[model samples]
Target: MEFIYSHNLTVDGREILLHIWDVPNSQEQAEDGSSEEKRIQWADSFVLVYSICDRASFNILPLKIQFIKAAKEGQSQEKVPIVIVGNKRDLHHQRVVSSEEGRLLALSLDCGFYEVSAAEAYHGALMVFHGLAKLIPDTKLALKKGTGIRGIVKTMSAVFARKRTDSL
Candidate 1:
């Protein structure tokens, strides 16, 4: 699998990091067991993305739920929000996963679910992150003091700059 694209977007002065994964097959394996764990650790919220065209991928929903449950169990009292995303809505004719199923699953898991088509530049993914950010208790305090969004961006930029400077 490869990362097709990534973008950093700011909404209401808050930063959001977006990444798109390009997997050749429905099955994804992490060469290093730590990579998946590391990603879960870094993410305070997760969006389980799936293509509506892939029927096989839909079968993995149980596994995805298990992973999320495990992650939540291992985390502190604060549970991370998990959003289920069904992409490729434009290909309705080829859709294998119906919106009802998605909704039912989300309802059962007590999470949010959305069906979108990125081909039209749908903002569903961004909305998911925005919602998660709002749900975080520290978001308002950080935004109010101007230490949350700006601080994170500044720190990230400085870290990358230092890495580049060191490599020179």
Candidate 2:
């Protein structure tokens, strides 16, 4: 089964909805009509993950990264940010992917790198989400700063525009 976790985050007075979906391993089938390859290209940002204890899992990441770049061809690569995370640090004794290897990969991609264990490192887990949040621009603040009732109307317009496009 496909696993999805949804959470609403209030950061800097703005409410951001984050949809965290785990990409299922099977490439042959999907519950929905669309393929995972098709859905991935539509994402605004990516949090590509791998288990530090599983070297094979870590090895596949390069192919995934390459696919993301190729899928986003012609668009400014910077616009589509990525955050590489090495999880299962709780089992560091069994870790197969070195911290240096993860850092080097992140540097190569020009994206942020974070090592956190969801089971143990509480602060580090939050930092990963916070780090990803920093990548997204706060567009609402710009709209909310305008003077008078006109500002409210402009903000409403923006909200509706976003909703309309989202429904499609």
Candidate 3:
């Protein structure tokens, strides 16, 4: 199943409109027959979510990252802002993927990491998207100022690394 969620948020005194396209990783075809490649191409940023209790789902994250990166090849001016979220965090007893593992993965990917339970509390889920929203403006500013990839990465790392809280 796919869902398009639209929300407007103000970050740093600027109102930003976000249209989040949520798609499953299943092989099923869309009604319009849109391929995975097309979806990756259309995305400006990515929020890759996996269930904390599902190791197989966590294992596939690297492949998905590769797909996103490959789809973005040669687009030097475009910054890839990605966030890795471990859902079902309330199920601590059933957890297969450690929060540490998720944090390390996000550090390696140079993106934000969040562990949230959509079923337990809404705040956690909101934080994940809000964090991503905050990244976009910084990314665009970096590009506009000609700070390049290194600058963008540095800025993003600082934001995600410092503010990361292991709420699990």
Candidate 4:
């Protein structure tokens, strides 16, 4: 099951829209819009997540990271920012991946690494996003355009106009 949500977040005092998708690994669903390749392509910044308790989940990241990098083959891979996250810090007793290993992997991938427990480290989780938000360009102007009723009205009008055109 894929859990998708969008939320407005305050990162380092700046408010921004955060779109998150918790996609489980499956070959069947990996074929379309929500695929790893498409996510890497569409994302301005990426948070690639894995559970610390799941060794297989952590192991799968290298290949996903490689695929992400391969998508930017002609371009500079460093231009694409990625954050490797090890979740479930509360389950550290069952931790299969060390923080050092996560750090080293992040270093090798030329990205950032963070370990956070959604159940406990709320600030730590927020900090992870704030760290990434710092790397992104200011989206204030674009975000401003998306707010309020005017934008919604314009969107609805466009859809109606398109439908009218298609019918004729």
Candidate 5:
């Protein structure tokens, strides 16, 4: 099953509205516009979650991250805010993927990491969303600055370029 949630928060003294898409890992697509490609396009940021108790789920994280990265090939990978989450933290006794492993993977991928249990405590889940929410605005601000710098460079280049003769 898939779930969607809306969150309202203030970041940098400005109100932001976020639509969180809790897309479950599945090969099947329903009639709705929930296909992987469409979902990837719809997302401004991503929180990819895997079950800590399931090794198979842990194994798929790299592939899933790569898919999102590829789908956003036009943007620099670092600009995309992706959080790696290992869910079912309360199932530590049954865990096949260690917190250390999850942490290392997130470090290597340059992503924020969290281990939370949706079935256990709501605080952990809230922290994950809030952390990512903060990151989204920072990423957007950086992109805007980069674009602004490029625009300035383009304008300067046009000014310095040889002028065309106005002969009709």
Candidate 6:
């Protein structure tokens, strides 16, 4: 198993980590195991992204749900937000999971749900993280203190700009 792509984004003062794994169709280990459990333990939140174009990916839904349940079970500190992301929203005609079904499943699992298009470098993923970050108590306090959203964005922008300038 290898991660095909990954991105790190900061939202409302919390680090949002996104990872996309590429696993062979023959791999049974990808479905469930101890390693998956370890990954869930490490993450503050989990967002499972499934491709609407592929029905095989839909089979992973049961595994995703199990991971969320395991996360909730193992959580001793606080509730970690779990989100089911249905990618390929641009292909509405090919949608496998309807918004209504997504909402219902999310409600049942007490998590969040969204349908987005990662093909366009989905900004919705960042927005979802931002929304979840807002729910963090420390993040909320920081925002209230005026040392929050604006400050973080400015600092991040400046840091990235400096990096780009140095590279140039």
lDDT of 5 by residue, 66-98 (tens): 877887756665567899999999988999999
CA lDDT of each candidate?
Answer: 0.63, 0.68, 0.73, 0.71, 0.73, 0.59
Which regions in candidate 6 have their CA more than 4 angstroms from the true location?
4-32, 75-77, 135-168
What are the per-residue Cα lDDT tens digits for candidate 1 across 87-157?
89999999888988888887887777888887877476667666655655565334434334444444444
TM-score of each: 0.67, 0.70, 0.75, 0.72, 0.73, 0.61
By TM-score, how accurate is candidate 4? 0.72
Residue range with the least summed lDDT across 10 consecutive positions in model 3: 159-168
- Residue by residue across 1-168, what tens digits does model 3's lDDT show? 777666666666766556566888664233343366666655567899999999988888887787677677556555578899999988999999999999999998777899999998889978987788777746553443434344434444453454533332
Runs with alpha carbons beyond 4 Å of true place in candidate 3: 27-34, 138-168
| Candidate with the greatest TM-score versus the true structure | 3
Arrange candidates, best TM-score first: 3, 5, 4, 2, 1, 6
- What is the Cα-based TM-score of model 6? 0.61
lDDT of 6 by residue, 1-168 (tens): 544344565765555444334444345354566545554443445566667766667567766677657665665656666777778888988776677766776677777787788777758867766665554446423343433444443443453343322221
Candidate 2, residue 23: how far the Cα is off, in Å: 1.8
Judging by lDDT, tell me the better candidate of 5 and 6: 5
Backbone clashes for every candidate come to: 0, 0, 0, 0, 0, 0
What TM-score does structure 1 among the candidates reach? Answer: 0.67
Error of 3 at 162 (Å): 44
Could you give candidate 4's per-residue lDDT for residues 1-168 as a string of tens digits?
A: 756456577766777776665666764245673345555544567788889999888898898778777775545545666899999998989999999889999999888899999888578778888887777667522554344444433433453343322221
135 Cα displacement, candidate 6 (Å): 4.4
Candidate 5 achieves a global lDDT of 0.73
Please state the error at residue 137 of candidate 6 in Å.
Answer: 5.7
Clashes in model 3: which pairs? none
